[model samples]
Target chain A: MRKFINEPSKVAQETLEGFLAIYGDQFAQVPGTLAVAKRVLDDKVAIVSGGGSGHEPVWLEYIGPGFADAVCQGDIFAAPAPQSIVRAAKAVERGRGILFVYGNYSGDRLNFDLAAEELQAEGHEVLTVRVADDVAAAPPDRANDRRGIAGGFFVSKIAGAASEAGLDLKSVQELATLAADRTRSMGVASAGGTIPGTDEPTFVLPDGKMEIGMGMHGEAGVRRADMATADETVDHMIRLIVGDRSLSPDEKACVLVNGLGATTRAELLIIARRTAWVLDQAGIRIHDLQVGDFATSQEMHGFSISVFGLTPELQKLYDAPGRTSFFSGANRH
Target chain B: MRKFINEPSKVAQETLEGFLAIYGDQFAQVPGTLAVAKRVLDDKVAIVSGGGSGHEPVWLEYIGPGFADAVCQGDIFAAPAPQSIVRAAKAVERGRGILFVYGNYSGDRLNFDLAAEELQAEGHEVLTVRVADDVAAAPPDRANDRRGIAGGFFVSKIAGAASEAGLDLKSVQELATLAADRTRSMGVASAGGTIPGTDEPTFVLPDGKMEIGMGMHGEAGVRRADMATADETVDHMIRLIVGDRSLSPDEKACVLVNGLGATTRAELLIIARRTAWVLDQAGIRIHDLQVGDFATSQEMHGFSISVFGLTPELQKLYDAPGRTSFFSGANRH
Candidate 1:
């Protein structure tokens, strides 16, 4: 493998150690657990999230003011242990209670729900909001069965903001659910990511071919076809997202053109350009546009497009200042 | 050729257009040049930098209030035209004059110097500071000939901070030079990056082999060796950097572990863990640590390490608030 890893089995632990070394001033590890929590806490609903370890800057790096209060990381492509999630929640539990906002994966849902049960038993009110926004993962009628992808970023942002604004746990959970409901995402993969210690990729694509709507961990996509130009690919993805959301003219939305592991920012920019054009043609106002590697799949070669149709309340929260190692929106509207 | 690009020749322009679409509220293009300037220019000396287009978030994305005032973009891996540089400088030039800070490359030097002369003739005081911190590119005695890599980030940050603090053009240039002098960087590439529209990579490496000290554009490095573990690779690179800089125990420095395109963040975090451990062994104080894709070679599967030795003056400046799309150090000391 071309990865800079020592022991494949210890990659996840070492990754967290590395992260703590740099961000230790603002965050700390929960004792006896692979959970990281913000150094300081306030008497507000605690927003917590996490999942597998391959996606950096997702759940861990997002732990800070105006974002997640804590995150419980798991092994590569695996779910965190229930105890770890409970510990993470307890680490940041204030009088207002705890709120969980995470992607909807079978393992993740099971573990987070179990953690919520434990926290409730311990006398802390807890609520769960699972994000399921991947349009290609299921039919519209089965949206709740779809896999959560990059659209979870919007859910996290809105939930974090609402919590930071002193919302009650139930209100925060409602806002997170609303954000998840309004968001839709689709990804195209030019290549697949390899797990550490593995010489082979999770999957393979012949040269000049690409897969549309591939999951973050190389799950089946909608289809495999010849590689298309950036404009064409983005146009197709946008169509699916817009149609899935039943978005209409005059709608205002926040757009995130996220790079899967290996895609270049330049390509993301090109994709963003087409995205803006298409949305404009449909009379959709882009309230905000972010282009970067918000969520990744190891070294996968592709990108995902996410649109979060904004309600006025969600828009206000989205515009609130958020500071994280990988993202910042302070002093801006 | 797995990139999502419609026309390889138009990638750079499209990248800029995409960037403008997202950031137009705060930045605007120069009337007749491929240059981006901040919409609001303070009376302080304007700090400007630019180079080839492949390194996204480097020159253009760095334009903001406490960062770069303007940036002139070139084609992929090519230098911006002198006229474009002049136009960009003029767009942000205030009565306090302008300062140009960029990498030390033959094409860049020729163009930026020509622009400085033109700006001088137009009665706008202009100063230049070329960053040559890539230790592997030249021997210590010929440091002036070294190529600038990720260390330019430190130079720009310091220069921008000084300029934003209302320093004169000469002072800003001097501080930039100091930052460049104290910074050093080296990279390892397991594979080469392919320029857009090109069928082949800029260079090639045999499978399981890696190049040490490789340049961003696949320039020849010091040596090729069998791929090593992340700890071993980081140790080798750190040894060279510490020895070349004559770094001593108790010295303070800021560290940047920059990912080339395609390197997974998990790998980077593992690298950072090793970096912090190694620096601790040397008794060097890490004043700050940043790990991300500050500079990148398009989809190149490798990373670079930059060490910026900090003096009290530079440390103060480094701690000052600066905001950019890819970096933000605001609301913190």
Candidate 2:
């Protein structure tokens, strides 16, 4: 891959500078960190989220307006630092409180925890929501052992909606936790991503076979198997999601067919349509379905399926109005 | 390649159905086709543009509010029917008249011409602007033969800005034409896409080489060569765009480091930072810069850089804010 980076190490920092130039309006720079947050939330509970830097609009894209009060950005596939997390929380804290939501990575957990303590010390209430919705990352017994992937969207939407509903800090935290509990994601990778200027694949798969249940950073898949037809692949993912959720025949759900890094809209719709049919055949009702690159892997050639069991209450939050850079919709009101 | 589509033909229709279901309040269907427009502009010069289905948020995404009065959607990479185009134009046209801006393609040109005729017969005045900014698709003598790729952003932004300025029909049309003329694009492709249910790639490329200047549909590239580094690729493209436009060190331009399909944000910025630097070295100050899958070829692993020799006046229009489904920026006005 021919890349224009100064060095692989500087890629994330330089990119943050550019994003800050455009999105700096909604975010204030955190001292000594590559984090940004909303300019105002006086007395309002603040929601903070972060992950690797490769997913363009996922973490950072979901910030602003009714979403995260602030976001901490780290290098590609690397967690943000403790100082960064604390600064992000402080940057968006309006004194109502602060809550941190992040993928279930050890580094992210440690840093966010450290940040939580710092916020609490400052006389502000602070809570944390760890989103570990990836089913393939670990067994059900250790669901939280899985890494957070595209389910970040569900977490983001629900959290933003809860905050916008004028819920207090505890209520907001509970709402986010509830949504995270019900959501699950599974991903597959056709190819691995390359570090800028590097020629080696981050992970490898045999030609004509896909790494099912692949991680966003091209982590090893649960299995390497022959490339299945579209229906077969989708059916496998849908079955796992449906089986795990144990959706009743009349259950309602919201679906997201996410492109990791390089999947196309054409392919996304393919997943969306088939996934919808799978649900329809199972007599599951879909209130809303979105197909796009909501979460990506810097153009990795694979995708993930994310599902959230929804009720009239959760569905309303899922449909809540949002003003993200990529996705938008009406408020639950 | 797991997809959500049913019949190949139904992908566009069904996805649009979902779009309306999710965004019904912000948009209304165009009577019969997969096209839609904002409801308020029944009398403004309806600006309708579209090409294929997969590149969501492009034609339809740039629609709404201050951008396109309405948009027409074609079946993935297929130009919409004349009937659909006519209906879309009629629905969005205010007394100000209507103008259609789209890529320079035989299917698009044929259908848009027929739609213009259809509208004219009904006593609706209409005009068309053909975007031919792609530098890699055609030879210089056949400049009009070049295709429109990511440069569509430049075209759409200018049109919306002009219309929002309340320029008369002819003046707006001319401004759009000028904007289209001032832009050029060069793209690279890393992978190919599969239509839903199909096993074959829409197009194919050697694993170690890149299809330079490929169209957004996996069409043939201007050339296929060894994968160059990102800096080299950006440099190669800059040379072509500057040479074609005779841009000098003192010229001002806007840059779009557009993902062809599935390239990640991390990758886009990796290249975009270099793109910005390259332009800076040329003594060209970017009036604006955006990087993402503004135009794509499904999940292809490539991106394109579009340079628009924007004048201060044109840049103003480009910067105007409007809200669309896929993308929205506030107009500086």
Relative to the unseen true structure, what is the C-alpha lDDT of residue A162 in candidate 1, on a scale of 0 to 100? 97
Q: Rate the local accuracy (lDDT) of all candidates.
A: 0.88, 0.76
Cα lDDT of model 2 by residue, B42-131, tens digit: 345678888777766567666766678778888877889999998888777877889898989899999999989988998998988998
How many collisions between residues are there in candidate 2?
34
State the lDDT of candidate 1 residue by residue for B143-205, as single tens digits. 999998988989999999999999888888888899998999999988887899886887799
lDDT (tens digit, per residue) of candidate 1 on A192-264 = 9889998788779999999999898899899999999999998898999998886666568999999989899
Q: What number of clashing residue pairs does each candidate have, in the order they appear?
A: 0, 34
Q: What docking tier does model 1 reach?
A: medium
True contacts kept of 1: 0.79
Query: Which numbered prediction scores highest in TM-score against the true structure?
Result: 1
The clash number for model 1 is: 0
